[model samples]
Target chain A: MPPETPQPQATVRDVTQILTRTRGLVDPVLRRAVQQLHPHIGEMAGFALGWRELDGTSRVGQNGKGLRPAIVLLAARASGARPEAAVDGAVAIELVHTFSLVHDDIMDGDERRRHRDTVWKAYGVGPAVLTGDTLLALAMDTLAQAGTPQAAAALRRLSSTLLELVRGQAEDVAFESRPWSCPDAVTVEEYQAMAAGKTGALLACAAAVGALLGGGSPSATAAMSRLGRHLGLAFQAVDDLLGIWGDPEVTGKPVFSDLRSGKKTLPIVAALASGGDGASRLASLLGARPDDVTLRRAAGLVRELGGLAYTRERAELHLHEALRLLEAPELERTAAGELAALARFVVDRAH
Target chain B: MPPETPQPQATVRDVTQILTRTRGLVDPVLRRAVQQLHPHIGEMAGFALGWRELDGTSRVGQNGKGLRPAIVLLAARASGARPEAAVDGAVAIELVHTFSLVHDDIMDGDERRRHRDTVWKAYGVGPAVLTGDTLLALAMDTLAQAGTPQAAAALRRLSSTLLELVRGQAEDVAFESRPWSCPDAVTVEEYQAMAAGKTGALLACAAAVGALLGGGSPSATAAMSRLGRHLGLAFQAVDDLLGIWGDPEVTGKPVFSDLRSGKKTLPIVAALASGGDGASRLASLLGARPDDVTLRRAAGLVRELGGLAYTRERAELHLHEALRLLEAPELERTAAGELAALARFVVDRAH
Candidate 1:
C-alpha cells in the first residue's frame, strides 16, 4: 500500500522547527568558508552574503533563508546518514547558491536583493563576477576538505550539477533575448528544462552530495537526488506564482515586478501557452519596455485566464512527486517525516 | 657543486623539442575534456579555445601554446611519476587557464584574442561568463575523476589557486581605476604579488597537482610547485615587457598597446617607482586616456628610465630561481634538465 500522506498541520510546524535548527548549524559553517577567501574578495563575498555592509560594517539577520543547505542536511539525515557528516556538503551547496545569485543579479541587471544593493551595484561588475568565481572555488575547496571517502564522488556530482546550472542560466539569457511573441518562442518543455538546469540540478546535487557524504547507498542517494529535483521545480513554480501575485511587502519587490521586466517565468509561459484571447491580450501588453499600467493589465489577464490556478496546481503536483520519492525504503522513517514536512513548507510558504 | 647550466644553444633546442612533444599529448586531452561539456556550452567553449569559429567551422592552428599543461606533465615526470598518469590534472589546469582567459577578456573589454573575436565579443557577455563558469566546473569534474588517493589534495590546491587567480584579477581591475600618478599607486612589490596570484598561483597548482596525481612524494610536489611559481613570474614579466616593446604582428596587439591603454604593468610600475625626472615625465605622458603620440613618448621615457632593462632583469632573476628549485633531490636528473631548459625558454620567448 502507498504510504499515508503527511498531516499538513503537523508538517508545517515540523518544517519551521527543522529549518530553524538546520540554519543554526549551517550558517556558521558557511561564514567560516567565506572568511577563508582572500581578504579583498572575501570582503565582497561577505557583502554578497549579507554578513557585512559595503562600508565593511558587520551585519546580521539579513542572509538568505538557507533553504538549499537545509535540504542537504535533511536529505542526508533522511538517508540514515549523520547530519554532521554532511556539513561540508551543505556549506558547499549554499556557497554555490550564493555564487549563482551574484552572477544572476549582474546578468539580469537586478539592483537590489534582500532589500540591499546587489553585489554588482555595490562593487563594480568586475568585482561582482570575481566574487562569484571566488565563492565557487571555495565551495569546491570545502567539499574536498570533508575528508570523507565519498568526497571525490561528491565533488564530481557538484561540478556536473554546476555545469547544468550554467546551462540553465545560458538558456534563460538566450530566451530573454528572443522575441516573446514569436510562434517559436520558448515552449513549456523547453522552459521546464531550463528551470531544471537553473534550479533543479543544484538542488539535486545538494541532496545527492549530502547522501554520499552521509554514507547513504548509491541507490538511496539517487532517490534523494530525484526528490530534490522535483522539490526545486515546485519551489520555482511557487516563486514564479509569487513573482506576479505575491505581496510587495513580503517579496520585497515592486508590484508586478516580473511582468514589468517581461520575465518569461513558468506562470507566464503557461499563460502564453493557454492559447486563447487572454494569451493574445497578455502578449500585447508586454514589449521591449512595458509600463506599469500595461503590467497591471497583463497580471489581470493572466489571472482571468486561470494562469494562477494552473501554476498553483503545477506546484502541488511537483511537491507530491517529491514527497512520493521520499518514500524510498532506505530513508529513515523520522528523517523521511521531516523531508515530507520540508516539501510541504516549500510550496506552502507565502514568500 | 651546482648542476652545470646547459649551454644556451643546446637548451633552446631541447626546450623546443620537449614542448612540441608534450603539446601533442596535452592538446588531445584538453580537447576531449572540452568536448565532454554539455553540447550547447561546449560549442561556446570550443570557440573560446579557438578550436572552432563562431559559425561552428572547425578551426585549426589557433590555440594557445599549452605551456601550463606541459609544465604539469614535465613536473610529473621530473618527480619520477609517469606523465600519462597526470593527464587529467594537466587537462584540469588547462581548463582553468581557458576559464580565466574567457572571464578576463570580458573584464578587460578585450575584443580580440589570438587575432580573433573574444568569446564575449562573439557571443554576449552573459554567455561568455557562463562559458567560463562551465569550463571551471568541468575542470573540477575532470580532477575528481582522476581516481587517485591524492585527488582530494589536488582539488584543494587547484581551488585555492583559482581563488588566488581571482584575487589577482580583482586587484588588477582595482589598480586600473586608481590614478597612476598617486603617491600610493601600485608599487613594484604589489605588482609582483598580483603577478604571483594571477599567473604564478595557477602554474604552481598545475605542477603540484601533477606531482600529487603522479604519486610523487610530498617534498617533490612542493619543489615542483615552487619551480612553477618562479617560472610563472618569469613568464608574466616577459609578457609585460612584450606588452610595450614586442611587435604587434607577433603579440597580436596594437603598437604601444599597454602604454596606450594606461596599463599598470610591471615595467610601468618600475618606471613610476624610479623617483626622478624621467618618472615625472612618464607620469605626465600617461592619463585617464592617452593618445598615440603621448603613449609613444611615455614608452620612450619608460625605456630611457631603464624600466625595460629592469623588467627584463626581473624576468631573468625569476628564471634563475626556477632553475635553482629544479635541484630538488626528488627530481629525476633528465626531467630536471628538461625543466631547466623550459625555464630559460619562458623568459627568452619573443612573444
Candidate 2:
C-alpha cells in the first residue's frame, strides 16, 4: 500500500492539513475528467466546477471543500489500501456531488453559492440542468474506466446511491408545499430518512467505494459505510444550525435563509415537536412564508424552545457514533486517527 | 439465435407486426427495472413511463412507441445474437430515451406528450427532473447487471452517447436565444450536427450495443452503428416533415406547433438556406413569434420554396444509405429484411 507515510500525532488541526493534501491529489484528476467531456458540455461543467469563468477564461476559485473526496481517500487509506488506487472513485463521487449541487441550486432558486452566483443564475437553467446531467453520466463513465476488480460493484453502489439522492430531493421539494397540520406532514423520523438519502447515501457510497476499491474486506467496507452515514447526519445537523445562526459572510447565505423559506430542517422540526408556547408561536409564524422579521422571530423562538440545543445534541450523538465506527480493529491506526480528526472538524466548522 | 424465429416475406406491413412483438418483449423488462427503484422514485418513474396514474393507481395507456428498443433487438438478431441476451441493453436504451424526453419536455415547456399531459405538467417540474435523473442512473445499473461479457463496453458507449444527447439539447436551447442575424447563429451544418447528436447518437449506440452483446464481429458492429445513424437521420427528417404538415390527431400535436414555436427544424433550415422570395417571406414570418394564421402561411411558403421536397429527398437518401449498410453479408438475411422494412416504415409513417 505504498508504505504508510510517517505522521505525527493527529489532532483536529491535522484534519485541515490532510484535507488540503487530498484536495491537491484529487483536483487534477477532477479537472482532467471534466475536460474529457464534449467541448460545449466540458466548458459549462468546468465553469460549474469553479475551474473556469463563464466566458471560457481560466479561474482559480473556491471549488467546494472537496469533503466527499477526502472521505473517499481517507477511507481507502484506513483500509490499508493505496490511496492513489481510489482516485477514480474520489473523482466519481465529487462529480456526483457537483451534479446534485447544480441541480439543487436550480430547484431551490438559490442565486448564490460559495459567495458566487449559482450556475443557473450565471449561465441559465437549461445549461445548468444539462451540465448536471452530463456530470452524472461522466461519473459512471469514470468509475467504469477505473479498471478495478470491484468496478462493477462500485458502479452498482454509486448508481443506487444516486437514486436515493434523487428520492431525497423529491421529498424535500414535496415537503415545501405541504402543510404541517396535514396528515402527510413529514415526521421527524421521515425527515431523518430523507436526510440519510439526500446527504448520507452519497457519503456512505464514497466510503464504501473507497474501501472496496482498496481491497478491504467486506466487513471493513461495511463499517466505513456506517461511519460515513453517521458523519453525514452530523454534518447536516451542523449545516442546519448554521443556516439559522451562522454569519452570512461565512456561510454565504442570507441570515435565516432556511427559516425564511420555511425549510423543514432538523432544528425547526425539533422545535415543532417540542410542543409549547415557543413551539406554537414558531408554528404560527412558519405556516405562511416568513419575511425577514418573522424569520428572525422564529429563530429566536426555536432557540428559546431548546431546538438549537436538541439539534446540537443530535449532531454530537452522530459524531460519537461515527468515531466509534472508526474504532474497528481492521482500520489502520494512523488513518483511523485522521478520520476521527475529520469527524470533529465537520461538526466544528463555522460554515 | 432462437432458430431464426420463422421465415416470412418482408413487406412494409411487417414492420408494425415486428415492432408490436418487440414492444411486448421490452415493456415488461422496463416495468420490472422501474419497480426495483426505491418506492418513491419507482412510483414516480412508473407514472412517467405511463405505467400508473399519478396517485399510484394502475393504468394501461400509451407509453412511447418503443422504437429504440426495437432497433436494439432487431440489430442483435441480425447480428446472430440471442435476442433474449440483449434485453437489458434494450431496456437501458429505452430508459435513456425516456430520460431525455422527460427533461426535454420541461425545457421546451411542452405541456403534452403522447396525447396526455407531460410529466412536468402533471407532476411539477421538480419531480419530473428527478424522475429523469433516476431513470438515467437506473439505466446504467440495469446494463451493469446484465452479466454480458460486453457489459463494460456497453456501459461506456451508453454514457458517451448520453453526453452527446445532452450536448445536442444544450445547443438547441442556446439556438433558441440567439438572433439569426448574429454572426454565430446556428447554420445548416450546425443544425445537422445537432440533429445527429440529439437523435442519431442514442440510436447508433442502441444498434452497436445490440451487435456487441450478440457476439457480432467488430466490422459487423460498426456496420450496425452506421445503419442506425442513417436510419436515425431519416427518421428525424420524417419527424420534421410531420411537425410542419401532419395531422394533429395522428401526431398528437397541435397543428403547426413547431412553426408556432419557431423551432429551427430541418425544413425551416432548408427553407432559410434556399434564399429566394418564398424563403424571405418564411424568414420574415419566423422572425417574430407567429400566431396560428402566420404559422399556416409560413408552412405554405416553405412548401412553395421546395423545402418540403428537399426534406423528403434527404430522408430518402438516408434511407438508401441505411439499406446499403444493411446489405453487409454479416447480417442475417431475415433480420436484415425486417430492419429494411422498419427503415421504410420510419420515413413512411404519417405521424
Candidate 3:
C-alpha cells in the first residue's frame, strides 16, 4: 500500500453510473454461468443473487452495490484492456462475494439481509448450504474455464484469497468467545487483521484477477492487489460505522446491530480498548444481557469514547492509500480516475 | 466404458495391500496441505478427517477406505509415472472428498459417521461450515500451486467435478421431497444420473487429475476418467445394498435403513418399476415411515420384486466395465491390475 497521506478528504465523485454500467456488463455473464447449475440449485442461486423472488419469480428491488465487480472491471480497464475482457473475472468475484454472504448469514443465524429474509430463513438450512456451495463452485469454475495460463494465475489468486477469507472469519468468530473487556479483549490490531482477511481478500483477488486477465504486468497485478486490500479495509471500516449508527431503513439492519450480537467489529473493539470510564461502563453493560435502552446507552458510550472518530480516521487513512495506488503511472489514467471515484463512493456509504 | 461382459463375476482380489500403501503415501501429503488452514479450522478439519479425536488427541479407528486417493495414485502409476509424482493430486482429491463428506453430513443432518460424531455434531454448525470451506479452499490451492500447465488441467477437472458433486447432492435432496410412488416417481434413469454425479464425478476427477499430472496423454486421461466413473457407480450400487441388508455392526447403519428413510436407491426404484404386487406393497410401506418390522417386510418385498437382483446386476455391469477399461493398452500392466483389484474391493464392501 502507498504511504498514507493524511490530507483533507476530496469531494468524492458520484460512482453510481460506473457501478450500474459494470453490473450491466457483469450480470449477464454471471447469470449464464449460474445456468450451468442443477435447476434446483440454479433457482436458489438466482434468489441469493437478488435476481429472483423466493417463489422463483423475477424480482426488482434493492440489490448489492456490486462494488467488487466494478473494481474488477475498472482494474482491467486500468491495465488498458477493454472492460469486456475481464467480465468473466468480474462474474467470478461477484459469485464469491455472494457465496460468502450466504454462508456468513447461516453462520451468524441472521434472518434478514438487504431487507429480505435470508436464504436459510426462506429455503431452510440444507438448501441454503447447497446454494452457497453452488455459488462458490461456479466462482472457481468460471476462472478455470476462462482460458489458460492467465486463468492459472487467477485461480492461484482466488484459492489463496479463499484461505485468507476463512482465516479472517475464523478469527472473527474466535473473537466473540473472548472477554468483552480487559486483557483478553479483541485489540485494534486484531480487528484490523480480521477485517483485512474477511473483507480485504476477495477485493484483492478481484483486482488481481482482473488485471491479470486484462494482461497487466506482474508488477501491476501485485500493485492492484495491494490497492484492493487497502480499499477493502476502508470499506470495512465504513461498514463498522453503519453497523452502529446508520438508519435501519437505509442500511437494512437494526441500529446497534453489532452490539446486540457482541460482534467484535472495529468501532466496538476500538472503544473498548480505550481504557476509559465509558469503556468500563460499556463493558459492564455488554457483560449483561442489555435491553434496547441499554443498547442505546452502549452505542452512545462507544461514540463518546472516540470509537466513531477513530474508525472514520482509519477508513480515511486506508482510502487515501488506496487512491494513491490508483495513481501509479503504469495504469491507464481515465480508468484509474474512475476507480478512485469508486473507492471514495465505498467509504462515503457510511454517511 | 467397455461393453459389459456378463460372464461370472471373478473372485474379487484382496486390495488391502494396495489401499494401505496408497494411504501411507497420501495421508502425509493431505496432512501437510491441511496444515495451511487457520489453527482453529485445522483442528476441526483434523477431527473431520479422523486424524484426531474431538479433544485434538491423535486417534486410531476404522478410517475411510482411502478409496479415492488410492485410485489417484494408482492411476498415476498406470500412466507410467511414479506414484510419488501424483501425491499432490492424490492429496487434492482426498481433501475434496473430505470436504464433500463434511458438507453432506451437515446437509443430511447425519449425526454419526464411521461410528464417530459428525463434524457438525462435534463442533457447532457454524464451525463445521467453516471447516468444510477451509478444506475445500486447501484442495483448490493444492492443485493451483502444484505446477504449471498440468496444474491448470487438474484445476479445470476439479472445478467441473465440484459442480457435478453439488448437482448430485442437490438432486439427492430434491428426491426426498419427491413422492415414494407415482407416475412422477424418481425413475431409474434419474437415480442413475444422480448417482453418477454424487459419486462418480470426484472419482472421475481423481483418476483424470492423477493421469494428467503424471503426464498421461489426453486420450489416456479420458479413458481413466470413464473407468473411474464406472467404478464409482458400482461403488454406489453396493452402498445401496448395504443401506438395506448389510449387518448393522459392519455397516454402521441399521438394517433396512434405505426402506426406513424411503431412499430411492437402485434396488427400490427398479423393484417399484416392476409394477408387481410386491412392488405395490413395498411402495405403500415406504409411503409411511416404516418401523423396524415394517421396514423388514418392505425390504423383503423389494427382494421379492427383483430389486436386489436388479441392483446387483447393475453393480456387476459397471464393475465389469471398469475392470475392462483397466485392460486398455495405454495403461501400465501391474498398476492396472491393482486398479482392477481396487474396483472389485469397492464393490465387495457390501459383502
The C-alpha lDDT values of all candidates are: 0.84, 0.83, 0.87
Query: By how many angstroms RMSD does model 3 differ from the true structure?
Result: 4.4
* TM-score-based ranking: 3, 1, 2
Cα shift from native, residue B212, model 1 (Å): 2.0
lDDT of 1 by residue, A100-203 (tens): 99989888888877778889898887678888898998898887766667876888798878878988887888788666564876787889999999999988
Residue A178 local lDDT, model 3: 96
lDDT of 2 by residue, B1-351 (tens): 566643333444597688788878888888888877667668778877778886778877366767788889989999997788688899999999989988898888888777778888987776777888889988988887765568767787787788778878877877787654335546778888988989988999999988887788888888999988898889889989998998888888888878877788888887777765666677778886778788888899888877789889989999999999888887899889888888888887743
Leading candidate by lDDT: 3
Question: Cα miss at A243, model 3 (Å)?
Answer: 0.8
Fnat for model 1?
0.61
Give residue A188's lDDT in candidate 3 (0 to 100): 97
Q: What are the TM-scores, per candidate, against the unseen true structure?
A: 0.92, 0.91, 0.96
lDDT of candidate 2 vs native?
Answer: 0.83
Tell me the lDDT of model 2 at B99: 92
Candidate 1's TM-score on the B chain:
0.94
Superposed by TM-score, candidate 2 places the C-alpha of residue A248 at a distance from the truth, in angstroms, of 1.0
Single-chain TM-score of chain A, each candidate: 0.94, 0.93, 0.95
CAPRI quality level assigned to candidate 2 from its DockQ score: medium
